[model samples]
Target chain A: MPQRYAYLGPQGTFTEAAMRSFPGADEAEHLPYATVPAALDALRRAEVDLAVVALENSVEGSVPTTLDELATGEPLQIVGEAHLPVSFALLVRPGTDLGDIKTVASHPHAQPQCRRWLAENVPHAEWRAATSNAEAAQHVADGHYDAALAGSFAAARYGLSVLAEDIHDVADAVTRFIALRRPGTPPPPTGTDRTTVVAFIGEDHPGALLEILTEFSMRGINLTLIQSRPTGAGLGSYLFWIELEGHVDDARVGEALMGLRRVCADVRFVGSYPRADQVRPEIRRGTHDQDFTEAAAWLASVRSGHA
Target chain B: MPQRYAYLGPQGTFTEAAMRSFPGADEAEHLPYATVPAALDALRRAEVDLAVVALENSVEGSVPTTLDELATGEPLQIVGEAHLPVSFALLVRPGTDLGDIKTVASHPHAQPQCRRWLAENVPHAEWRAATSNAEAAQHVADGHYDAALAGSFAAARYGLSVLAEDIHDVADAVTRFIALRRPGTPPPPTGTDRTTVVAFIGEDHPGALLEILTEFSMRGINLTLIQSRPTGAGLGSYLFWIELEGHVDDARVGEALMGLRRVCADVRFVGSYPRADQVRPEIRRGTHDQDFTEAAAWLASVRSGHA
Candidate 1:
């Protein structure tokens, strides 16, 4: 039997493009859902073998919806990730001039990316949000809006003409998408790997956050991203979404996780997967597995008065 | 002769309030400058004996203007700090209604704090930036703008009526201000103290940041703040502004500074002063001054085969 994969789409969305770029995506069944919740729900209900959703954007930090899902819901194992260069295109009916656009449609994430561009190019246009960029392009095809901001690849599929391509206020923006499945054994550590976890503060103390950070730092692990989100408990309370270098199987990472458990109120293990960039950290001298083993041996000898 | 103090003001800005909160502020000559650079420049040229500037805000993180000044040019010692609760007010001509406002003037920092409120209350108003909040209030008094976002305390000073007070997107936002002087003896170490330093990465490496963090973590010091700013060399190049607990005089802190010198290309020491809230860290075992002293003695004896 073949694996079935679900991604946010009507096809040609950034998530779909990212999903198609995965190593084994071509051999699986590709299904499109209208929103991230729907796609992930399909995987949760076992209707799909895996689901792909955008995790973080270089220009915008983490997607709030995805962060909330990862922080709460039933556990899911992130098996892999893909990076897609995000560039938007303005899609319009053939022969439509930029001045003719009074209302523009786009997904919320894409609006901020091209805010300055849209304000400058079509100063009179009003923005309308859609579920996805490809959905916006479809709405434009159906004459719901004068223009749509979407992937250029989406224009042809939705029977719209590309008015402009590669539009962005910032250059070299990339969105990172991750593939998740029902909790299972994580893929084998690839040496160059990334581990992610959500740490909840045990109590409101001046050093709670610092304690969590020291766990990883003392073991020579490097963090790539750390975001604080309100835990809905109230103001002044926050939970952190942390991504760091190394697989949980690594001795340093495992020790750090144990340290986190002791400091945090409750520690949620998201997943440890191979890093997309494959950049390996230079393991420092005292943080190696052998170093820990040797230190433990030395401590035992001293404790037994046999030094 | 009494000392002269410089702060950003025409009068009634948040900085002035913070300056007034200082223990010896009433004994000094208060001189107001138009901008942060101007106030610091006055001190740099010895025109003013000291200067007070906002350093960081609980809600907004580090103030960019202060960070840039602290990172470069002639170094000054931060001898004391004050934390002020920030709340804004809208000042307008007497008898002016909110609907009568067509333009809003404020310092760049004030605008974002009231953006959502203004959008809901005065959707037609255009935003204008002023150098300081007090300057904005003065402009409104001069009839240059319909309204200004400033402190309520400015209303009486500028002869403008307060349209609204206590305007904030988030409550309990506190801005931390620092008092600086030309190179002098640092304040003696208080049990509760914070030391700040800026570390420049020598070369691009995967764990450069992690290594710097471990130096402090291994010694059981807690970091209160860490912000990474671009070194202006390129995108990946960065310098970190770090504030950690414990004065530079602490044995653990001294060793951590030595470790940082070995790893970083350059480390700039900012003065350590008593914490505003006076929260002391729990000194863990193996990291106290006596622990370091005893360990050194033990090593020396062992090297001489007299252990």
Candidate 2:
């Protein structure tokens, strides 16, 4: 049987495009889920071999549902990641004209991306929401709505016309999606990788976060992203979500995690996976696998007090 | 003449409620805008003396619209903040029964907050979007929809009956709203205060952030919130939003800001304002005005090489 993979769908959504871009995905059996949690739950239940869900967007910092779900329940390991450049087109029925477009439909996330274009070109249209951009196009195709803001692929798949192309407010919008599997050993470090973790402060005290950062700073680790989400206990309580450069297999990263565990109430390891960004700075001159091995040998020799 | 104020509305929305809670708000002229940017733009244009906008929600983290507006264009300073406990109620036309409700209308934000309740109680209801929660109730009252998820105030304002009460998914959900005025001197320190600033890393060096945090860690500053937003230029670039204890008037905080200015490409000060959380641990044991004054005098005496 072909390996089963799940993605948020009703087909032709950006997520489906991302899943299709994965290696060997064309040969895999694809399953569609109505929501992010549903797809993740299917993976957890072993209904599929892998799952893909959007984690963050360049325009919208993080997807709250994805973040909250990953923070709780049975832990899921992120095995890989994909970056998709997003561009939305104004989709409408074949004979629909600009003046005939009265109600614009799309997923809530898609609306804001084309706010400027909508305001400038079609200022009088009423905004309507749908489950997905493809669903929005499907509605337009079915005459449920006059127009929609969706992917070009969605327009093609749903048999809708591209009334206007590349209408997103930002030209370089990108969304980062993660591939997840049931908790297990992460992929081997690829020299260019990112490790994600959630840290709960041991106590609400002044300088608590400083201590957490100190561990990584002293080890020469670089943070790619950091965000704080409320713990749901109260207004002031929060859990820090951090993404840093390095893999758990790296000695410096392993030491930092150990130090964090000692200082935090609990540290939830999301996973270490190859970073999605294609452009990255060259690895630091002095820090790599061979350098760490040499340093470890030097420390061992000095411990005998015979250097 | 009364001072004019603007908030996200068509009236009866939570933003309006938060605006009304501001001191002396009743005496001010209230203007309702259809969106957050509209209200802030009105303030920038001098159409309003102040603007009130939702900043963060306990469950949703930061509002991207508000954060991006604050980070760009002509800067607006946050003068005050309000904490409103959010509780959604199901509003329906008089004599409408639960089984009779086939469609539920609400603002997108309200819909998600009651997702669990709706899924459990009214599993078959089709969700519809409205301009605002109050507007949702208004539609239901006008016989356009069967029910809405809105605040109790909205139900009363729209002359609708509450069919179900307190339907929010999280019991402790609260939204933090900030009062903004044209860039000016911030309000004086309240002994308990927070200073917010946005920092752009000068160079994408390995430990650029560590250098920025060191300035605060050495001074024992406690960070209340921290988030990174893309600069919109491309994928890897980001602007860090930071909220830390101490007013800008406080010596340590002022010094930290100065230090950040030296290291960062640019630092934008959002404002120094009193926090919204009602219960707070007494400001750190000895970091108040008296201690700072005494320490200054002691340093002067010791500089003479005599005590």
Candidate 3:
């Protein structure tokens, strides 16, 4: 089958890396788009079968465009999700040394991750933003910059040498990207999963928003994230993005979603996918109960309303 | 006295023009920051006595960064606001003509506004995203593109001649910018105006969001726009921005806000001012009635529960 997945870019982007993380990724053609809306438009027109868009990065909170696109009533439905361990590094032309770098170029998303490293190494150098890490790497390759902040994949793709690996200030540098498809073409389940949905309303008057939320709380549904984006209608109302535990097709979840739809103007089920275990079995061999206990505690807080 | 304002760029951004709309503007020193967080940090650190940030543009909706910054736990208070008219035009190098342009470069916000113009005139051309309109103009000057979508102010500043004026599709394009400060130094009421506040959480577990909104309904607080940004904690939680009919200091508004704070986790007043009577008074006369009518209708909706 000729599979097409639309992603934000001019060919190479971190989202493309995330798309490649899909199970049956080999031989899939990638469609590059200038904006998320354009990608979704292509999906609606059936030009692409799927879209891989970045939702949130641990360091950057949420991609408002992704949230907004989901809330804007797209005919596309989210089918699967993947979380890629985003590891950023400083890349430069093949023969360039760290000391030879006068300027560093990168996407804004990369700048924050490499903040500490950039400050310590090139404190006074000017930082410029290119369209993507791949573009930044290309700029470095074209001799526009002595160095660039980019992902490992981008460096390899552009044939640049990594001057430093894993320079992100935070050890937990991860980004969650989602796949979208037309309704009824859902990705097969992988169990231990989660689903995302969004709703829009004008007067979430006092209890309106919560009334919808209670449908999940009463059912013991584990909600992961809730966010809102302005509807651009000039009224102080919103379109909300919400994530909850279990697939939307699950009996309890199905009932909850039905109840939510009745209360919200527009409600959409984005997707259901196996929640990513950032650390694979091989990587978690020795760190067994250490982080797991912390994760459980955080989940408990969320369940108890403290979160 | 050193008054400071923050805009979204290293220098020469449209936000700078909006920031200049503040009263006693000559006393304000422009502080350029790469991101909104940097500016908010300056406000939090007392490094700047006041900060002006762009809240939203009529064509592009609310700026997520500004909304995200407002929702942060901070003492910053909104005390005043201004609506600046936005006029996007196509600019080119001294010798470049309309037909010679193979690409249109602009910030993403300008892209949608100029979509019609681009499609009609530069149909097959590529659209490149620049860091800012000023940067786009600079790139055009640097021969990166034959033309760029820029504001009149940017064209003047960069010495790029305007090839087309008022090319944005929206005739009423305006951006609402707000002035913020630490709690103790709220901007004095210029009188005969309005105020902005953000509220979150609700009284009852079910329909909590709706319950809090009731205060505005009962008190006739006209909400101009309400958007929710992620608190980044868990699902079904958010921070809401609400624009109302009167200043928070007004007795009725004061009572409503006080009541709301008791029911909500936070009821923050961002700022308020007399709504600008005209965005482009000289160019377009007497179109303010449409906005006022819309605002009045929204206010009635809040009161009647139809919104």
Candidate 4:
């Protein structure tokens, strides 16, 4: 039996494209969800063996819904990752001219990505928000709107004509997607891997964050992203979402996690998985594991009175 | 002559409510801009002396557009701030029943804040996005929609009756608004103050961020928020937005700023202003200035051979 894989969709979404790019995704039964939470819920309910969702957009940073969902409830671990270069195309129904466009629709995230292009080309068009880019294209195809800003895949799937291609304000926009599964052993360290964790401070005090960073810094782990989201307890309380360059299975990485668990009020290990981007040679330069091994050996010798 | 102030609005939006709460707002000529960038642009063009924009919400975190606008272009300094507790009311035409509601409209931010209430009360209603909460109320008053989720102030302004009150999922939701003006001397330290800065890393090397945090950690500064946003330079590059507990006028804060400037590729001082929330006594317990002064005095005595 084919494994069931869920993605954020009405089909033709950038998320579906990301799901397709995942290894072995072709052998899985594709399921479409109306929202991020819905898809993650399906995975939680065991309706799907795996779920894929867009975690971060290079242009927009992290997706808040996905981040919040991952942070709460029974733990979900990212098992794999994928990157899709994003390019929006203006989709219109057959024979709809630029002059006939009164309202342009797309997901709120997509709207701002093409702000400059829309302002320059369709200055008078009113903006409408959709649940997803593919839904926007569907609306246009269903004659609810004059045009939509969506991916080329969405235009093709929805049977719409592309009035404009590569409409994003930034030329090289990319979005990173992650494959998630029930908390389990993370994929084995692939030499070039990334670990994500959320650290909640014990108290709102000076140097609390410093203590957390010391674990990673002393171990020579480079952080790729650090974001603070309110803990919802009140103002000034936050949970730091941190992504660093190392796999949890690595000795140094394991040590850092152990140290963080000791200091943090709570620590949620999101995942340690192979990174989607091509590994830069610089990321693999140092082996903090070797340093840890040597230091442990020296400490043991000193403890045994060997000077 | 009265000064002119611009805020995100047509009028009666939560932003206007925040602006009204500012000191001397009644004496100033208030102008409403359709969006955050529009209001900031008005201030930039000298059409308004100051712009009041919502910077972050306790529930949603930072408003990316406001952060991005402040990050780019001619330097803008946050001179003051205000906090408004957010609560939404279901507004409808006088005689409309809850069951008669077919579509609910509000700004995108407002919709999510009341998600639980909407899901439980009107689960089948379609969601519509409006430019502002006030505009949503206006739509309902004009019979375009059956109801709107907006502040009670908007309900009164738009002549709609509240069908439900305090409908936000979280009762304590609060938004932090900042008053921005052209690059200028920040308000003098108020004993209880906050400093916001953006630090751009000099390079993407391991431990780069650790070095940046050291300046604050060594100075005993407490960071309130730390977020990383893409620098628009492409993948893997980011600018760190940091909020710490100290005024720029403080000796320790000045030292940290100097240290950051030396270590970071660039440092933008967003502002040092009084915090809207009450200051915790613990934040005032230690003055790093005294520490710096004592260290300097001790070093001088040793260097002069007086020890």
Candidate 5:
């Protein structure tokens, strides 16, 4: 059966770029929505078989709207994850000199990626907000702009020339995307794997949070990230977002999570997935210098529980 | 010495409403920034002695910008929390009929609260995004739109008339605001209190989440709410936002938090403040209604766990 997937798109959205990495692309249908919530709705109503949504960007934090929908909407299992290495470009109408431009337009997320370049080179240009990077390119085509900070794909798709390539401050700017479906048994692990989960608990008092962390630590389990949102139930209560190393079926993993349940008033398991490969040539072979010192230090500390 | 303060302002913003509740209001020197990050930066640079920022809203989840800043920036202590009830109105030009309004403009957060009302009453109107509610009101005053959805205070401030009051589908809508400052000894707690904390960890696994929750349940500590965000690390770690009853000094709380620290790799205590009275009127000598039901349920549940 053909699978229909919805993403934030006109084309060239980092989400669109990530969604392209899905396996068996020929059999999957693709659709674009203006906002994350709209994409989730289409998935909820069975309008689509799968939804590829941008969960987080390396420079920015989690996309809250997507996270909120996941927290409150019907349970959806995250069947797959992708880490798309993002490289940004400054796109402009052909023959327009960079110095002649007086304004730059792009989505909020893209603006930050190009901040340093804009600050140093085009500091005085007005920064305008558009719905998406692709939309920003379309705006450049539809009207006059000094230029736009967008993706390489967006520039090509809109037929705009890349005035400057890879203008982002970080060479390894990547976005992590997730594919969600109605809850089902996780597909058999193919070599490498990762799992995701969500939970709600108290935030106030002294020992409440520590108790949850100790369970994994005691068993040598590692946690990836933890996020929270207000439950609108006054103070002291929150909706917690958590991810840890290993699969749910791993003996120690199951034991540790069950232990967390005993201490948290309420806990929910979102889903587990395969950790995306990090050494793809497209991601690692860019012209940028390969400096992993800071990343290595941070990861080592985290792996050692000292971070 | 007069303290420096920051609030979401331009006047008529819900943040302004929340900031009004702070102590030393008359003596504090105030600065208004267009966004939460701007204000948070002012605090981080020590340009301001304190900042009052909106963390969450009843209709929306955690403000991602606020949580992200707290997660990444210099250490900040959550000194207090407050709940400000939000009631919205539909304001229009003096002579415009409600049916004739073609567009409704407002800050993005205000859109959800008025969604149902707008859907049913003015289904065809397009929604415009504005910088703030007061700005939306000013837009209407300038006749850019036939109407706008805004707070009554905004309308009054901008000299617009309310075409309809309490137009939000949820009557008791409210926002949770957090008062933040550099780490300092909070004034001693009065009897009524709550504590908030954020936890970050380095693993991404399934039951790994439950392990963290068990700490609170075993000690009979009642949790209020939990929310999570990715920490922008490649390891897939999360920053968990949690709330719970009791204060830092309580024996049970101290023990529970100690237990949790063993589980979470990194944890920061965001705040512990007097649990402001919940959203229901303290003395609504009237028939049993929805607010009564909600408030009663909240109080009963907390009292049950404390017992």
Candidate 6:
């Protein structure tokens, strides 16, 4: 039996595009779930070998729900990430003209990216939300909606025509997607790897957030993203979704995680995987693995009362 | 002549209270400005010796407008800060009862804090915005509004009766206010001083923010607050308002600033003022000032072939 790959889809979506970008995805059995939670849940229930979900989009920004789900739920390890430059296309039935469009359907996130074009072209159109842009295209194909804002590639899959291509107010929008599997030892350090962790600030620790950032900073790790969200535990406690440069196996990164574990109320190691951009960390002097190892040795000698 | 102190006030407001907390406020001439910008501009124009404005609040969070004003405009140096516990009160005409109130007034920020209380007590009342809570009380005294949510102390100043006091949904809400003056020598290092700076990310630098945090982190300096705001320069460029634990004169902090200045496109030193809470940073073992000094000396010795 081939490995199963689950994604948020109805045949064609940005998520499916992201999933296909992965190695051996064509050889793997493709399973489409109606929702992101459904896809991840299937993976959690051992129904799928792996799950792919959108983590951050340049235009819509970070998906808070996805981050929260990954950070708080039963552990899943991120094996890798993929970046796709996103551009929307208006999909409609072949006979439908821009003037004939009365209602535009798309995922809530996709609609705003083309709101201006829609206003000028389809002045009479009202926006309808769908779980995925592919689902919107599916609806358009079934005569449930006049048009949809989706990827142009989705048009052929849904038997729809590209009414308008490259429909976006902002150019060069990119979405970063992550692939996850059952918690396991992460992929080996690639020198350009990225490690992720969620730090729950301890109660009554006023500067706990600073302490969390300091752990990575002191190790010369560059935190690519820091999204602070309420822990849902109390009156204003926070949990940070921190993504940083370096693999979990790196000496400095291991030390940083240990430091975070020591300070934060709870530190959850998500995983370490190769960065999609493959940009290597700019390791500062005295923060390299050898530096940390030497520093540890120096401390041990000092503790042993050696000069 | 007494030193002139400009504050965002019409008198008897929270800002006035914050301004009065200063050392020579009572001895100095108090000048009330119509708006926060007006108050700071007065200081900039050399019309006042100093200015005080709200920086952050536990209830409303950081005052973005005030922060942006100080960060982007002509530079002002913070010399002091005060944290005042905020609670609102309902003020009305002397003969009026709680039931007589039809419309309530308060600053927009203050109104939300007391929204639940107002809904429970004055369910029929409508909320009106005021420049300041004291102005709301003055409006109540002038019969412009049926009731005003303000500081209880404002009742005595505006000749209004307090119908209810300590009105807030959340308890222990504190607003932090900063005192500013023309750029000059900063106050000598207090062990618990806080340094503020604004760092503009360079045009092409990807992880400039991480580099900024690393500078502080590598020096064992704790960043008490990190507020990222758009530079308004372009579609995605950002500027960060970073407040960290240490004085400008501290060897570690100076080094951190120097490191930041080297990496960031531009680094603006807002000020180094005594922290309102006076919380000293936890200096890690190898990051203390003497450690940095010793490391520099060792590096120099090794470079000169003396190691």
DockQ of each: 0.02, 0.01, 0.01, 0.01, 0.01, 0.02
After superposition, which runs of candidate 4 have C-alpha atoms over 4 Å from their true positions? A1-307, B281-287
Question: Per-residue alpha-carbon lDDT of model 3 for A158-179, expressed as tens digits?
Answer: 8789888877888877898888
What's the CA RMSD for each of the models? 25.0, 31.8, 31.3, 31.3, 30.0, 22.1
DockQ-based class of model 1? incorrect
> What is candidate 1's lDDT per residue for B158-221, written digit by digit as tens?
9999998888888888889999887555678888998888888857699788888888876788
For candidate 6, write residues B1-307 as lDDT tens digits. Answer: 8999999988989999999999899899999999989999999999999999999999878998898898888888899999998888889999999788899999999988998899899999999998789988888888899999888888999898888888889989999999999887778877999988888876746566777777776557888889988887886688899999988767677756655654566777788889889898887755566655654554333223242
lDDT tens digits, residue span A1-307, model 5: 7889888887878788788787755678889988887887888888987788988888887888877778777767787889977667888988888787888999988887888889898778899998888888888987756677787888778889998886778888788899877666665644355656666775465755666776666556567777887766888677777877666655445545655554455565667677786321221111111222332343333223244
Off by over 4 Å in 6: A1-307
Q: Where does model 1 exceed 4 Å of error?
A: A233-237, A300-307, B1-307
lDDT of 2 at B270: 85
- For model 6 chain A, give the 10-residue run with minimal summed lDDT: A298-307
Better of 4 and 5 by TM-score: 4
TM-scores of the candidates are: 0.51, 0.50, 0.45, 0.50, 0.46, 0.52
Give a tens-digit lDDT track for model 4, residues A1-307: 8999999998989999899988889999999999999999999999999999998998989999888888766678898999888788899997888989999999999987889888899999999999888999999999999999888888778889999897778877899999999777778778789888888865788877877787676556788888888877788778989998878767567655655654567678888889888473143323345644654453333223242
Ranking by TM-score: 6, 1, 4, 2, 5, 3
Per-residue CA lDDT of candidate 2, range B171-199, in tens? 88999999999877777777778888898
lDDT of 4 at A204: 80
Write down the worst ten-residue block by lDDT for model 1 chain B: B298-307
- TM-score of the first chain in candidate 4 relative to the native first chain: 0.94
How well does candidate 3 reproduce the true complex, by DockQ? 0.01
